[model samples]
Target chain A: MTQLREPLSLISECGLPAALEVMGERWSFLILRAAFNGFVHFEDFSSELGIARNILSNRLARLVDHGVLARERCEHDKRKVEYRMTDKGRELLPAILALRDWGLRHSDSAAPNLVLVDARDGKPIAPITIRAHDDRVLEWGDLAWAEPGDVATAPAEACAEEA
Target chain B: MTQLREPLSLISECGLPAALEVMGERWSFLILRAAFNGFVHFEDFSSELGIARNILSNRLARLVDHGVLARERCEHDKRKVEYRMTDKGRELLPAILALRDWGLRHSDSAAPNLVLVDARDGKPIAPITIRAHDDRVLEWGDLAWAEPGDVATAPAEACAEEA
Candidate 1:
């Protein structure tokens, strides 16, 4: 693995902090999950999440402000509003799924009441994985950081040799 | 797509809530990131993160209690302690990477100062993806939930037909 000579410097510039600012809290994530489940109306989020009206309102507004969810008027009824996931919001699916999967494996609580399946085969979805550019499955030891210029010179066989 | 006839019912039992209970805070995640970067000593986390001593102590204990990290006495210097990621903590890599990637794209901040690379070839890592059991890449529309028994009866060609 490539050593981080100054880990602090790298950590400061990392995007995780910003992502956490928008999504670190519990309610926000629960709301996003509800949105993924196709709940659009304010009432749907409020009732389903058991979130207080004020807190739900705050989270929805924050999501909208951050471009994670879009706020728009209902097409048929101008007075009715809907909260929908934007492209950016949709991109978070992997992160959400990873967390959900981790929880399922690690949580000592009740067994999962539902499973995420492939609609085509109705089979459970495969666990999320980290893959190399060549589609090789990668474990933690397989990852490293390097200077941009170093990438081009490194050989594809390097991994094989390391293994 | 399989409709969530009762979305709330599923959300109520999701593992996400439990996962969030352990990892839903900003500092905990930052600490975990530091761990991934190879920082193990208490001072390493403290000085690198500039976190308050008391807060850091609390978060570390919580992580230890949840089994996300293991606290051990330093082998070389038994008087000193080190906090290391356990297998469960290592499993969170995908989730952390996903968030970091999302932030890099969405955060209105400075360009990333570092990049995650494949040690073998030194190339940048690929984006995290949701893949089918057969290794087909899946998008949000491609996903659905169904009863466990329905999985075996569903045709492999079902996805092709829907597409």
Candidate 2:
């Protein structure tokens, strides 16, 4: 028998549930994350994410339909439509940053790691991790962030040491 | 003319990308979170998460298939399958911790809040926020987290602070 390896959608008739439902699939966030990472072109997103063309088409359109993204065609290349984040989508940056922060904490020491650093100075961001109050800083700590190359302390030992 | 949206799909692929992609969805983790919060039966999972039954069914089955969770026919009710996290699923603590850490850091304070204070203790989890490090703490100072809930500062300052 052919095995279905991925998570199936929440099976029901509630739109409110569906609101969070669409984001439940594994592919959904990867797609969203890629857009944030600057992979806007269809081919670039598809290839880098290694997602199937058909599924990619469906998910992308659905995200747009839900108002999470905006797109445009390159003037030089009429065939290419570039995808960008919308205000609503950008609102999801908290979620993305959360994930990136999570990844940095848990996957620390991964070879060829993906780390966030300040673009201007090329320093690391951390301890000072950002927290959003509304459209502004929630506290002095919300301003905390890791720069492009900055790495956080290993989580396992951090807790133990701090404790 | 209609605007286009970038698509989502990281699940169908394999490796940590697919793992992160699939688990990154809202309902997926929320459902898991609900389970962690103590809802086991289909109805409980549905009721608490506000997810549809069909989607819940599919997700549960898929989670079991992935070995992240295990199921047993309810001894008292043969027709019902009770779900429990397997060691594999429990091991997902890091991932879920990452999610909540992110949610607390970014999720809105209003409406269906993604709050996760210890059910055991009323005191909100603080100073345990995740960090990205490479020996030294990443320093974004105030821009680190995206949500006010994660800030370790006093509640009045954090909750009432202007965003």
Candidate 3:
């Protein structure tokens, strides 16, 4: 977790930009997403994400380096390697799901439907929805200008005070 | 919307970094989230988000200039300006929700919980979650494999890949 910084440059959260700056790249989330998808081996991640071997190697190293994922050699295949999420990486699932849901809503969909739920259990662990102050679900433009609830604690300078 | 590129780099859909690049930034999502949370004035945004005047001014100008938000002189206060989400801006609700959802998950009551619901009646929109094919909620490491999934089509390679 990142430490909250004192308000600087008009933005209350200093960690916001750093979070965005580090996370704002393109492939990091998907790679993390795939991790949740259960492709633990180097070859499997490559096959599932369809990332280049070179790129996979780089991202894997970065994730491990960042302590988001842990790496170990595959026992079955001595030459093979396996990766798993650290608490830090596990924490990213919410963000990943949020992005998937957003993509499904704003853009065209591919059948895989980023989420896979238990048909039998009818339960999902990662369907992270945003709700209202009273605990009701919330949406865009729902705020009435009187109360800006559930606003993202990110950089406000780039965005307007619409919240 | 960005075109689906070959999985040349990590920023492809499978990666959270990619989503961050597209949606996560200093002010971009904050502007949207604030709108969703009910903020509407330049000063209010400056005050609440604590954004620097220059940066806030720039973000407001860009969003308005890009038609994401419309700047209408306050109906009553000519000196006052009200920023409203354009339909296009409204369309960004999902993305904003997505990131907010992400934040709620990684937080520990240090942050408030979030959800999406109806504005008129305050009904739940459903909590957000993410998972993998087995209907199992995925942890980031579950998919960390050496084999990059189908990233052959990515337009560019991830920087870390080169490093």
Candidate 4:
């Protein structure tokens, strides 16, 4: 008699889903986009996104509660509050920029879209990519999933490269 | 006094919002995650997400309509259908992977979670980054928006580096 151990399958992590749960809504990302572009007051986001005041208030409050944005009393005006990105919120920039870059490259826009440039050089920033620690550019083919704590045998290919 | 020319303010692009409009819903991204991991049949998504059938049906249809997923008859079964990621869908990997990577690095998970590894060498992929044309690593301070047709003059620094 012979026995064969089934290969251990890695569990799919839900971190991305959890993120989407918090900021994946249409208005939320746009609000974040506006904030990144220096829009802090409620009126700015409202005018920029054309969103109603009530909706903007709800979205901003939710972001603040999630620790993505901080609501502090405006230093210049005691009666006004300003929203700024917290450290947690700043960590989200890569993902946001990834989406923005994808949209810029893949979208079918009839009108010219805003271009992201280096603040120092005026050149457009490069696309976001997954590179090896050795700096090799990786495609989906170059990836596989591993269960945490698994013995680090050479990982097998997850799938073949798409044509 | 002469009228002043308003500095050319760049218009924020809408592609990211359009993307969110398609796959920004809570469950939609989860479904895409499953698809990227090789889930295709309706039953697989149903079991994995534990979502109601009607809701799943709606989400799948929406994804198909948005060109993110393609619907085709299952080869193994004449009556069953399978969903596959289209080229447009595949292009979204950087963004999705960015979100996943962030969640893995920043989430409050106390236990081991799934990890993405190099299919070739079994090493973990590097974190996604915003880079310059010369391959210099970039930060928030290194970026700013430019109008599409703005002069190609050198840009000034957006902000100072963070610690």
- Best candidate per DockQ, number? 1
Task: Note the Cα lDDT for every prediction shown.
Answer: 0.78, 0.50, 0.53, 0.72
Chain A TM-scores, per candidate, are 0.81, 0.60, 0.67, 0.79
What fraction of correct interface contacts does each candidate retain?
Answer: 0.66, 0.06, 0.17, 0.59
Model 4 clash pairs?
A: none
Q: Which residue runs of candidate 2 sit more than 4 Å off their true CA positions?
A: A1-22, A52-54, A97-112, A118-163, B1-16, B20-27, B46-58, B61-67, B70-82, B85-163
* Sliding window of 10 residues with minimal summed lDDT for model 2 chain B: B116-125
Model 3: per-residue Cα lDDT over B1-163, one tens digit each: 3433435433234434333434544566666556645689988887766668998888788777656788999878899999988875665554454444444444443533233335554443433334332223344334322223332222232222211
Q: What is the C-alpha local distance difference test score of candidate 1?
A: 0.78
Clashes of 4: 0
Query: Candidate 1, A77: how far from true, in Å?
Result: 4.0
- lDDT of candidate 3 over A5-119, digit per residue (tens): 3243322232233444334444566667667666688877776667689978887887787677899997877998889888767666665656654444444434332333333
Please provide TM-scores, in order, for all candidate models, with all chains considered together.
Answer: 0.85, 0.49, 0.52, 0.82
Residue B154 lDDT in model 4? 30
TM-score for the A chain of candidate 1: 0.81
Q: What is the C-alpha lDDT profile of model 2 across A1-163, one tens digit per residue?
A: 1222223233211122333444555467778877766678889877876778999888888788767788778889899898888766654553455544444333433332233443333333342232221112122212222221332322464344333
lDDT of 2 at B149: 33
RMSD of each: 7.5, 13.7, 12.0, 10.1
Candidate number with the higher DockQ (2 or 3): 3
Q: Candidate 4, A20: how far from true, in Å?
A: 1.9
Using DockQ as the yardstick, the better of models 1 and 3 is 1
Q: In model 4, where do residues sit more than 4 Å from their true spots?
A: A1-10, A111-113, A150-163, B1-10, B148-163
Candidate 1 steric clashes:
0
